[model samples]
Target: MADTISTKQIIKPENLVHKKSAVMTDTTMHYCPGCGHGTTHQILAEVIEELGIQENTIGITPVGCSVFMYNYLNIDMQEAAHGRAPALATAIKRLMPDKYVFTYQGDGDLAAIGTAETIHSCNRGENILIIFINNGIYGMTGGQMAPTTIVGMKSSTTPYGRDVSLMGNPLKMTDIVATLPGTYYVTRQSVHKPGNVRKMKKAIHKAFEYQKKKKGTCFIEVVSNCPSGWRMTPVESNKWMEENMLPFYPLGDFKVPEE
Candidate 1:
């Protein structure tokens, strides 16, 4: 009988293309299949590791699918009430000025119930990062329409489709935030594809770097897909988001401090 070669001895470690970030805990993510939260968390973990701020960073998670972020990311984390992440983050940052503070919020948490908190915190020029994941609908709350839910977008609340005339226009929160004087940097990105993922990673890195500089609110909005909420498969949601969501929430930097 021929001797079997050991697998570890056959493959070189140098050829490895990707590895899990050390900042991410072994805890399994609880996000729905094809949800963007997992990818977003991975990128955030990579940024924290690469910036060498893993030990000094503090994250605030709001009431939404992202609430589990504290368990997945191997860093100090705090939980806040629905739409209250910014408020909690503001206090945390004020108390621990030396720490890298950030908030992970969903569309519903950031743009709806937490609207006041979100606006006030950014307006105050808090030196913290806001990672907003916008999937248009309230993903974790039985797919109800959210403040960011676009026209004609279907949700449990809008079974037929979103009627802008009756429901009000979709709130462009990122654009609104960018216009505020306290916001030092703002950008919209996605992570459905490899190129977009790379771009989003860069944006996250820049946000963290700016945070260190004490730059006022660095907001990064991730226009992501929610297959479960959208009533589609992961691939279908990605394609639909590309065709429908991207046009309204265009990707690219919306604001940056002038040198």
Candidate 2:
């Protein structure tokens, strides 16, 4: 008779390299399979827990795919009106300066209706972090063309692909804000690959540190993929994003602190 080892023996604790952060609740995530939002939330929770700020952190998210972040992350959270996360975050930070306040926003929420809030808050050097997820389309609202949608990109609204003359050009919101005086750090990142995920986590950690210093606004744009919205499988969407989206919205630190 052949002896069989138990499953526990096959998987040992010593081999465990990763575990869910306690800062994340057990609530089931509603994000689509293979969506980058879940990964982003995990990294965020890990960072908050690592910094020992779970009890003091406050996150604000507006109407969009990111609106339900509070349900996933175990931290103080606020829901804002459509595209108003930045405004809400600004108010929260002002009232409670000691709290780690940040806004989680999607492309439509951050680059379109909330553009004014995003601009003014950064212009004033609001001591908060802004996590912008730019998937190039309005993922929650039926995959419509968003402000960050690249030219020649096709969405529900632009079935023939986006035309610069008809639809105007894509908004480089991250670059626009980086040039403003109030921004201390600005970067564009992605989470489709393991290396990119690590880079994003590092950027987020640094952003929170800067927020602790009350230096200025730290804007990080995560160029993610919308598999359902893009009418492609998760793998295809990632490939498309790398080939088309990244070229228009390159990933890297656009601006950094003087030091």
Top-scoring candidate (TM-score): 2
Cα RMSD (angstroms) for every candidate in the order listed = 3.1, 2.4
Off by over 4 Å in 1: 1-10
Which lDDT tens digits does candidate 2 get at residues 1-259?
A: 6599787876887877799989999999998888989989999999998899999999997798877888999899999998888888989999999999999999999999999999999999999999999999999999999989899999999999999999999999999999999999999999999999999999999999999888999999999999999999999999999999999998999997878
User: Where does candidate 2 stray beyond 4 Å?
Assistant: 1-7
Q: Write the per-residue lDDT of candidate 1 for residues 116-204, one digit (tens) a residue.
A: 99898989999999999999998987899998988999999999999977999999999999999899999999999999999999998
Per-candidate count of clashing residue pairs (backbone under 3 Å): 0, 0
